[model samples]
Target: MASTRPLLLLVLCSLALADAHFKVFNLRGSSLSSSILGHADAYVKVFCGSATLGETSVRNNNPNPWWEEEFTHFKAQQNDVLRLEVHDSDFGFDDFLGVCQRQIKLGTNSHDCFLEKGGTLHYTYTLG
Candidate 1:
C-alpha cells in the first residue's frame, strides 16, 4: 500500500519556507544627543541583502526627531538581516550618521540598536 506521509512532509516544508512581510512602524532617536545644540537633517535608509528596500524622509535640522513613516516589504525572509542607516543630507555630499542591523523574525516586535556613532536609534518592526 502507498503512504501519504511523504506528500504531507513536502507540504509542511513548503509552508515553512514561505516568505514573510516586514513592516517598520516608526523610528526615534535618529540624531545624536550631542547634536542637541545643533540640529541634524536626518533620514533613514533600509537595506535587505543587496537590495535597498525603503527610506524615510529627511527630518530637517531636528535632533531627537521622530519619523512616523511606515514601510512594508513583501520579500522579507526569516532570519534575514535588516540594516538601517542614518545620514545627514548636505549640499554636495551626505554625511554618514549611524547604522544598525537586526535579524528578522515572525510576529510583532520592537528593537533598539546602537549606531556606529555614539547615538541610539529606536525603531519598531513587525513580521507577519
Candidate 2:
C-alpha cells in the first residue's frame, strides 16, 4: 500500500507538469524607430525562458513591419516566461529596439507591448 501510494503521487505530479503547445502568430509593429539613413530593418526573436522558439525574417527599410509568420514551441510549460525581442538588423552590431516579457497562460492571449525605445508590437498567442 505504501509503495502504491508513492507511485500514484508520481503519476499525478507528472500529469501536472505535462507539456503544452505554444504558438505565437500575427506579429506586427507600428511607428518603429528609423535609422539615421532611413527606416529600420526590423526582425523579431521569440523565446521561452532560455530556449529560442523562433525568429522572423528581417524587413528592410520599413517603419511598419508586418511578419506573416508563426513561431511554435511544442514543449512549453504553463509556468514558463515568454520573451519577445525586437531588433534592427544593422551592418555590424544589431540595434535592440525593445522587448516584452509575459508569463505563459492557457487559452488565447494578446499583447500590445510598447517598446522601450519607440514603437508598439502587437501579437497573439495560444497555449493548449
Clashes per candidate (backbone, < 3 Å): 0, 0
Tell me model 1's lDDT, rounded to 2 decimals.
Answer: 0.78
11-89 in candidate 2: lDDT tens per residue?
A: 9988866888889999999999988988889999999867898899999999999999899988888878999999999
Checking candidate 2 for backbone clashes, the offending pairs are: none
In model 1, the runs with Cα more than 4 Å from the true position are 1-13, 30-37
Cα distance off (Å), candidate 2, residue 76: 0.7
lDDT of 2: 0.91
TM of each candidate vs. truth = 0.80, 0.86
Number of the predicted model whose TM-score against the real structure is largest? 2
Per-model CA lDDT versus the true structure: 0.78, 0.91
